[model samples]
Target: MSEALRRDYRVCEEIGRGRFGVVHRCYSPESGESFAVKSIDKRLISEDSVDRQCLYNEVKVMNLLTPNPNVVQIFNVYEDDIQLHIVLELCNASDLFERVTNRVFSESEAVAVMLPLMEAIAHCHSHGVAHRDIKPDNILFDEWNRLKLADFGSAECFREGELMSGVVGTPYYVAPEVVAGSEYCEKVDVWSAGVILYIMLAGIPPFYGDSATEIFEAVLRANLRFPPRVFHSVSPVAKDLLRKMLCKDVSRRFTAEQVLRHPWMTSGGETGSVAVLT
Candidate 1:
């Protein structure tokens, strides 16, 4: 085998698969560091323009992230003529989807997770990185329940001291400015983080519909709702904070730091909210 093809990866088992490629648990014999190997099929890209550049961007961006406590770390990159390989640190704990699919996050559970979630997002913003995609799948918990933000494929950099423009992010979580074709910036990331917080507390996303248009419409025109069941034990201050974070207007949403200061964020009670990213 070629030296590159002869890597000492254990190739444990398949953990994820998407249109672009497959992800597997792998480990290095020399370092003994666990890694998630994402192999993208070159066939997935027809033209070598923006798509290919994006593939490369994922590599470059991961390299640039500060070694913050919450951000996923990229360890190596490899490619054959037919496939691009990205190997990243494996966050072995369950993700938000797993938590939700299984149902329930006790108040203490929510608080413990949110603290790290906010810290990570704050760190990303401080580093000039925007996690354009925020949803349950992206959030993960290690055995210690430590939160780590995963997946930077959709992350983008804003111009220095400049906000962002155009639409980017999951449909339900996209901020109003992004959805309305107005200029947006890092605050959009805060909006997604809020959505994540809501999910952790409440167990479901605030916006949902029969179709994408309907869901987007709900996000754009509807008020985010919280139920009494969710609020039964949650404090008024926490609900008030949720009201602020999930606000429809991008300008109106609470910043990650601001949300971090919310009483509930510290107290750790939640009823419902948006999904986590993978």
Candidate 2:
């Protein structure tokens, strides 16, 4: 543990763990406030390694995108000889991955989730940042049931009209262009969000295989279909939006702003608040 961190906050038990660190539930005794602190061990990462750079990049990106309701807010950073501690806003509720595993979401509920997510993506894109690794595991819910997009480890910043080249992101949520190793823009996030929507409504990913390579093959194919057994009840409007988002041709792929403007998202419905799944 970092002595600087211990001096500032009362770090508690482990709440989560990741590749290079463990997350602890911490408390600010001064204000009686709670927060999550991700403590990364410096020994595990080399000084000139990409992993170390990503750590710095994640902090920089999160700081750039702070104050956005849909994004996780960072509080403080404490580094000692052994570890790096990042103090962040705590989300007591489970993540979207856990929630989806329990039950399928109705169209309205999916809309509620998608709206805030798109808004967050739009916010990121407008600020020249691409959250290259958007997946269910990173979609968190706060105490108020508001969705908060977390984890910027794979995020990158780009200039206007510039393209990013990287195979970053979960297999199921990666865009076809990314799979093809082509240069991509912020629209890649929209594609990933579409995959999340498909999973939310159908309880399965649109593309799947027995292995990662096969899944990548299916993604490269970009053959999207809604099986009657699962999608019969899903609205055509919803599917239409999905098609636009999951389109293989990046030229036709819907941007985050376009997705928010779609009929299904704009039609009569309560989107300002997300559904509190039981």
Candidate 3:
């Protein structure tokens, strides 16, 4: 298998490392196209059984959503006794976290970046997959500056009317129900996306604390505020959508599909040709 990979492509420098594997830059000698190869050591998987399951689950979800412009594209999978290799579309421009860290995005810019993401998450939900984690780091941009949602390690499929109770996700971006260990639906991803949008526009998270405990408490209370310093210039429609997305009541929160059609999203006139799912 190693010989096959070496023969077909030139595997290059490491680009990313996660709990499941290390991602490396690889180029196909024939096509001259670049791709990412995630190498997960079988030994590491043996040590933590769940890690292997997560790796396979990520692959399953990525494969299920293939050809979607807003989701990372997985090309092939190579496996042997040593490790499992999954080839993915390389986003040379990097993830949204880096972009957000470098500069504050205006409301228009935030909407442009988020519209596709909203569609991607909606598509995932429509297919019964829930991306338990939806933060800036999981959102990536390709060479064309097109946004793609990545990292499906925490994703799970739910039947109709199913509820998820796992306590997962980053503290600051987690939904109130998730923080309280209550069963949650795919809308939890909407809450997290709302947090990302808040950070993108406001230049900081809506919820914060000195420690995880305090952050969790704040999340449970779900007291959201858009202070004037950040939101002063933001349009009222944008704030209204933000409020809907961040609503503490799951029933009131906007689903990803609904968010894409919100007046603010449609009225911005900044949304590109994103393939929004119904």
Candidate 4:
């Protein structure tokens, strides 16, 4: 543990660790409240400026998030000569991947995830932020199974109506415009969300292969199977929603707002409110 750790909070145990550093489960002694502290060892620099820029961008985006139920609250940020710390709400529940392993989600439950997810994405879009990486790992569930979008490490901010040009994000969830070497906008994030929603309903991704190259080819071709065996009870309406969401052209795909009102999503939904301004 760093000597700079807040003495106000008792560092409990290591809850998570990865390339960045370690995340400690911490508890506030005064209020008996628990939170996760994300520690990034900045001293161990990556190979290029891109990695440093990406880390700094993540910090900037997290700092800009507004108070919203579906968004993870970044409580504090502090750093030392060797590490940068991010304190966040600690929800020790399972992720979408874990849920999918046990039970297939009903259309109602899928809608529950979709409504908040769409609203959160819209909030990001409205604030000129693009969460370039959207996937099951980045979505967290609280005690009530409510959804929260986490990890803005791959986010980019664009000027009014301007699109960014660069290949970013995970291969399986990347948008066509991004894959095709063309400039793309917020719709790219929508594409990734569609893939996530599709996985939630169907219990697997639309495109898959043994290697990254094959998966990229499938996404580029929009190759997929209808009525996948795992999705036996899913309705045609849900399938149609997925098709529209995964459209190759970002322009033709559903906007975050349009996705909120879609039949399969709104027919069984609860409205949510979220803001993304600093």
- Could you say which candidate leads in TM-score? 2
Model 4 residue 135 CA deviation in Å: 0.3
Candidate 3, 197-252: lDDT as tens digits: 88888888899999999999988888889898877776667778889999998888
The digit string of per-residue lDDT tens for model 4 on 1-278 reads 45656776788899888886888899888899889888888867664768778877887887787667887888777777788888888877997667766566767788877888888898888888889988878888877777888989889998778989889889889987888888898889889988987787777788877898898888898865676477656677777778888998677898887887786676663221111111
Candidate ordering by TM-score (highest first): 2, 3, 4, 1
Model 2: per-residue Cα lDDT over 25-116, one tens digit each: 99998998999999999999999999999999999999999989999999999988889999999998999999889688988889889999
> How many clashes would you count in candidate 1?
21
Q: What is the lDDT of candidate 4?
A: 0.80
Better TM-score candidate (2, 4): 2
Q: Of the candidates numbered 2 and 3, which has the greater TM-score value?
A: 2
Residue clash pairs of candidate 2: none
> Where is model 1 poorest over a 10-residue stretch in terms of lDDT?
269-278
TM-score of each: 0.87, 0.95, 0.93, 0.90
Model 1 C-alpha lDDT per residue in residues 101-202, reported as the tens digit of each score: 646566567677778878888777777878888777888876677778888777887665787765767876777667778877787777777776677667
For each candidate, what is the lDDT? 0.74, 0.91, 0.86, 0.80
Q: Residue 82: error of model 3 in Å? A: 1.5
Better of 1 and 3 by lDDT: 3
Q: Tell me how far the alpha carbon of residue 245 in candidate 4 is from the true structure, in angstroms, after superposition.
A: 0.7
